[model samples]
Structure formats: C-alpha cells, structure tokens
Target: MARDYDSQLLESVAVRRRRMRDALLFGAQRARRSTDERLGKVFAGIAIAAVLCAGCVGWSFLQATLAQQKQQQQQQYGTPSAQPSSASSASTSR
Candidate 1:
C-alpha cells in the first residue's frame, strides 16, 4: 500500500510539472504574438510616413520647376508697353 501511494505521488508530481511547462510555453507564445503585432503596426506607420515625405518632396520639386518656368517666360517676354511715346505722335501729326 505504501509503494502504491509513492507511485501515485510521483505520477501526480510529473503531471504537475508538465502542466507548468505547457503554461509557460503558452505565455511565451502570447508574448511573441503581441510583440509581432506591435512591430507590424510600427513598420506600417513608418512606411506611410516615408511615402508622404516622398510625395511632399515631389510636390515641392514640381512647384519649384513651375516657378522657374514662369520666371523664364517673364524674362523672355519683357514688360508690356504702357503708353505711346510723345516723339512718334509729334512726327506723325506733322
């Protein structure tokens, strides 16, 4: 009877140890999953920010190019004449 009791106790201890190990492994898996989710969110945010920055840079470049073209046009066209010269009018009247 004593030997049977000892065997039962040993079996119970082994079962408890297995339960503890499995619980620890499950907790570790949960933590790893949470970490991966957080990292995924962070990386997605970074990607979005990078894309926005790139778009802004492209927009700025386009605006600068347009401004440069406008300046060139103004330089090439010269200013418009506001009024006729007096010397030409006097010669035409005579």
Candidate 2:
C-alpha cells in the first residue's frame, strides 16, 4: 500500500494556515492569559482601596482640625456675644 504524501502535506499545510488565521483573529487582543495579569489587577484594587481609605482618614482629620479651630474662635469671641459691651451701651446712651 502506498501512502499519499501529497494529501498529508496538504493536510499539514491547511492546519498551519488555520492556526495562523485563528491567531490573527483572536490572539492579538488577548495575547497572554497570565496569572500575573490577575495578580496585578488585585494589587491595583488594593492600592485603590488604600488610597480611598487614606483620603477618608485625611478628610476626617481635616474636619476635626477645622472643628477645633472653630471652637477656639468661639471661645475667644464668645464673651461679646453673651453680653453686650459697656462702651457700646454708653455710646448709645449719648
């Protein structure tokens, strides 16, 4: 029995062409489905979470500082609000 060399060669060449076409169609968009890609995504999510947490903490600290300053200002100028100054009363009488 004689093997058909031409048919085998044509089959192999067709397989190669099919693979090349498939690669061209699908391989360019997602070349490597790597574990590192997943790991990098997780690390990026963690980094974003850390940044958001830091921002919240900084915002709370800023609000606390502003409240403290407001309290200090209120203490400094509160006496005039509680009771009218005598000099203003005297000037009003005149």
Reference-based lDDT, residue 73, model 1: 83
- The Cα error of candidate 1 at residue 24, in Å, is 19
* Global fold similarity of model 2 (TM-score): 0.53
Task: In candidate 2, list every pair of residues with a backbone clash.
Answer: none
User: What would the TM-scores of all predictions be?
Assistant: 0.52, 0.53
Which lDDT value does model 2 have at 61? 100
* Model 2 Cα lDDT, one tens digit per residue, 5-55: 888888999999988986876675544644557788999999999999999
* Candidate 1 Cα misplacement greater than 4 A, ranges: 1-28, 79-94
Give the number of the best model, judged by TM-score: 2
Tens digits of lDDT, candidate 1, 4-45: 999999999999998787677656577676688899999999
